[model samples]
Target: MKRSTKITMVVSAAVVTGLLVLALPAMIGATTWVTGVFGAGSGSPAATEPPNPTADPASDDGLVDLGDGISVPAGGPGECTSTAHISTMSTRTDDSGPYYSKLIGDLVDRGPSELASGQALTDEAGGVYAYEVAAGDSAIAIGERFCIDYITVQSHNHVRAGMIHAGNILYLRPDPTLPWVSPYEPFDVQPGEQTGPYYDAIDFMRNAVVAQDLAEAQRVWAGLGPHIHPDARTIATRALEAGDWELLRQMFP
Candidate 1:
């Protein structure tokens, strides 16, 4: 081989090596970029599968376990027997005979029109009330106590599987105009804001006056003692005694 030819070959080989060195880094970088963008090859970690969706609460026949041994059906009352729903009444007790008597007298004077058309007087419907569930209090018992249907109680409060906790506020008397809704959509109002109990008491008094049964009115008044606010009870007691239905109306209104 000629010396000049050998030198030319060496220079060509060096240039080729230099090009390879420069291009190798760019090739590696391109591979890494492709891997990152497309998640190709075992060099990259496998993509995490999207987390499984949460289970729906309405599944499993929509039966709600309200703790205790009780379980009630959700949605509209389905084969819900009143006897099965009723439980022992709450142990709390109350007595305000004179006040009840006076209230009964007032209801007698006012007549059924006042009771029937509660909206006319207070701008609120009659028979709607808020009740905190007590231990052993079932939908039917609460309904019977308030002279309402157990199914109505369950449907109104959306009580699932007859499940009612002790502190849960059950609203009585659903709006007649509104379409039936699922249990997931509850009423917007809180327990304290509900005036149904007061009106319920008044209704019972009115019923007793209509039946001409002072004893029944007194019994209803006693049952209502625990449900009524102490302040409202005091005001009601005074108002009934003083024949100041206007004051009673103000409190209820």
Candidate 2:
């Protein structure tokens, strides 16, 4: 063959090879392959992975200090409970007058079912603090003891005529809401502001606690961690000192 004809044939083969390489990816997959040559239009290493939902509370290198010693990465709820349950009145539950005293007695003489309703309530909803109840305690008094609104307690638990009964399970609200204001997404209010949406979110969480939805309760608590006000820090401090981690996890600096 002539030298010029041989050169033309070689150039045609090279062009075909380049086109085949470009079309190979699309042939292998149904989706169109439009990636730029080399590294063009590629994602960064960080974009390839999902963000971590669980974090170690101990690490605080990049956290911001919000003053008065409050900071992000302060932490979240402590260990979660294995299972969620509430107590129901059994045949032996006392129904006599002075139900509060009987309730206390029932707690003192609790069985080996390994029941700890106080801890259960705390884990499920971050309500209720003391492991024991008083002889003369009413729903209102219980609320007062825990530093929550009496109405909030009564409303949350569906109490009627302020009546008391032995062996009845109650959720406690030991911390005041002011100190740990939250910027949680559900409660879309200014850091220090308390508006309609905030209260709605609170009601949603309260209902979740009453319903014993542990997962939902924890989620809301985490979102509300940043709006805590300094004035209410004392109340928050007391609750944390008492180990009310579920509620404590909701407050922000």
Candidate 3:
């Protein structure tokens, strides 16, 4: 996993944790509007610190491709809820009891989780990308790698000082001119195409995981065949993306 992505994962854990602990009912709203800049408005930098360098990557951690050359760190069944394997879900279960309702109501058409996993991250500062720093990396090096300038890397990533180290996650601001997709309207490839969910297998994967119905999730994949990436994939990849669809508080809260 790249350092930037790992940072996103860690930050997500922290933000979501804090959101649950401190905001509870407000979490849905907080995450939902946290990054309007990428979606519909401008996002100003907050006085935030980067992720701690002390943590180590989970052995099972890997990357989930979110299209547009954007990827986020993901985990195995235990770490990620992206896959269709119920066995990997954390031992944590709702004290109320197992959530056994159909993922989606009476919709053999889709899983509840699929219906619930919600939208994508097509909105935002145009569209942004997160970059992970490697060992021995420097600002200039990062700039060169992405074809951005060193000054912009420092400013965009909020690197006020200190050397770039391994495990540092950097948020790359997008060039506003470039076109990006919207999570809610991902099927805009042409004037009237609605096959994205069907073609990309998003509806298939999301419904399975959100429903926690691995069997059904797997079943859908079996039908997708080569259209799906070998990694399969996750509908949720970043914090803003998670918030846009209320996936965080609902899925893990």
Candidate 4:
């Protein structure tokens, strides 16, 4: 009886060993799958990492394209504020004359007191001032009040001709010595059919000069090489080389 019991026990132990051997491979495979899912353990499937995103090339150089060949520094001028009293009126000019003619005529018609009364809140350095558009305010009238040319006001504020509305804030007297920075929206000027790309090119050149980016100004001039007149291109090239921002602004029609 003792001998038979020993044989049965031996057989049972051998069967148990065989079952463990058979289950070993499956246990290892399950462990490997878990490791792979958790991104751990050697020989596990390599985890696929997400690809890093690339930055905009223009942004790296701190430039933002404003379309129509105009590009400015990425971040514009700092916040501006003022507390100066602004006078409001309801004056409107006759639409009979040409736009430019009316603009000039209105400036001439304003008396000294009216001109003097057009005041703005000035900065500490007196290089810039904030002026609020009053009722019946025209670009030329605002320019006259601020003692600057209408074109300067228009270009600086990015105001379209005859588009000034009451309560619009305009920053005036940008320090020419400092780099050009505008808080206003980019000026959108389409090339006139008769004028060709002259206006667009001029606008770009003006912005480049105001930003004091000579290389960009030269690039703009070169891009317009084939379209603009030879004399105009020559003058523009000279102005760019001389760093003449005022000349570029004056080039506007």
Candidate 5:
């Protein structure tokens, strides 16, 4: 064969091979990613894999272990017997007299003052803290509790000090509204100057508690107990009176 013809054939073959390699990926569709056990065939039911073993609370870190704390099973309510007239009524109001009504009125009026004093108590103990903030939290108090500066929290969440509500999550870093040069550094604030938001947040929480929105109220009240005005004792009292163990646990635990 002529050298030129041989060279031409070799070059054609090389170009065809390169084109095939590039087209191979496009020719085959992307592979499907199947999670868990796939069926043996199209008509077969999915093969059942053994369930993941549940972790024992006693063996888990951060879990309350038996002997360390009483374990309540995750099922139904435990034994709580009420007294006569109602097996669970811890104390019966004497319906035969107007005296009990006055006592109830007095209890209602005294709640806010108690919550205010409760805040002072927490301050004294140095336990004010914030775990998370949804839009419902007092942005100012959250900033104070997490040691995030107030101005930054307000700007990041896009609310004035008093506008935050129950479900706003503020990003500590990369929130362009603050003067913080480094996002990771810890900081603290004096409580009273930026408390309007905190007060408003608590007021909303009080209403929720009164409305029997215990879980919602507890969520709002979760970490702000120290910040709660002693007057909140009224709210707490309502929670206690209503026998809401979960809310009470959040408050006093």
Candidate 6:
């Protein structure tokens, strides 16, 4: 893991802990929008701190890929729900547990505890990349450690350009295809500081419109706008091309 990513991971653990403690109840009481499986969003800078191996358990199974092509490892499950909602999920669960019960170490564990375990960082597709940043670590350095492009890492994680911290978890995975891209292409973006829940909103719009489920699209787009990237454009262009002005106006307007 890269230093920046590690720092992000450590901060993510603390944030999840705090969120579960503070925000879980409100979410449970409300509609509890499904955000985790969608997009990324902003949060405090505290999450950019790197992990301390002595303080953080370096070897644990803190990751579980949701098979929807989204991987939720312990550290950077950005903007997720405190309570799990299985019924609405489109992916199979590899592990299930309450947020509070999960330990800080177990949740942030990247691989196994020892090289002898055969689950060492070397076992990963790319060798385990690790870094340590104090007050001086550049955002570019952090991005390099994690093997993510500077922009994608920064934008997706909601960080300022060229800013990061120390003791972070900078784990890397080969870039995967974004779920909503192929059609939207180059315009896939979140307006403002939008995050996970917004992606759910986008997904809802996508299903309703592209899937030819007009009612569903209408239901979700009730609050959408022209500024919404890619999808809004894709949907509008398709609607206009097909002479479905009603759908285009409803979605883009």
TM-score of each: 0.23, 0.23, 0.24, 0.30, 0.20, 0.21
Runs with alpha carbons beyond 4 Å of true place in candidate 1: 1-128, 176-180, 184-253
CA lDDT of each prediction against the hidden true structure: 0.32, 0.30, 0.30, 0.37, 0.28, 0.30
Residue 179's lDDT in candidate 6: 12
lDDT of 5: 0.28
Q: Please give, for residues 170-201, the per-residue lDDT of candidate 6 as tens digits.
A: 22221111111211211223345544555456
Question: How many clashes show up per model?
Answer: 6, 12, 14, 0, 29, 19
- Lowest summed lDDT across 10 adjacent residues in model 5 is found at 100-109
Residue 85 accuracy (lDDT) in model 5: 9
Q: Which TM-score value belongs to model 3?
A: 0.24
Which lDDT tens digits does candidate 5 get at residues 1-253?
3212221232223132221211111101111111011212111111121122234553332322222112222222222121100000001132111100000000000111211211111111122111233433454444333233444334222333345444332333220111111111111225345645654654455456446576776666664444533333444555545655423322231
Q: Tell me how many residue pairs clash in candidate 4.
A: 0
Name the lDDT of candidate 6: 0.30
Higher-scoring candidate on lDDT, 1 or 6: 1
Model 2 over residues 92-169: C-alpha lDDT tens digits? 222110000001101111111212222112221122232233344554444322333334333223333455444344
Candidate 4 ranges with C-alpha deviation above 4 Å: 1-137, 143-200
Q: Is candidate 3 or candidate 5 better by lDDT?
A: 3
Stretches off by above 4 angstroms in model 2 are 1-194, 230-253
- Assess the local accuracy of residue 217 in candidate 3 as a C-alpha lDDT between 0 and 100: 50
On TM-score, who's better, 1 or 3?
3
Q: How does candidate 4 fare on TM-score?
A: 0.30
User: For model 1, what is the alpha-carbon lDDT of residue 248?
Assistant: 29
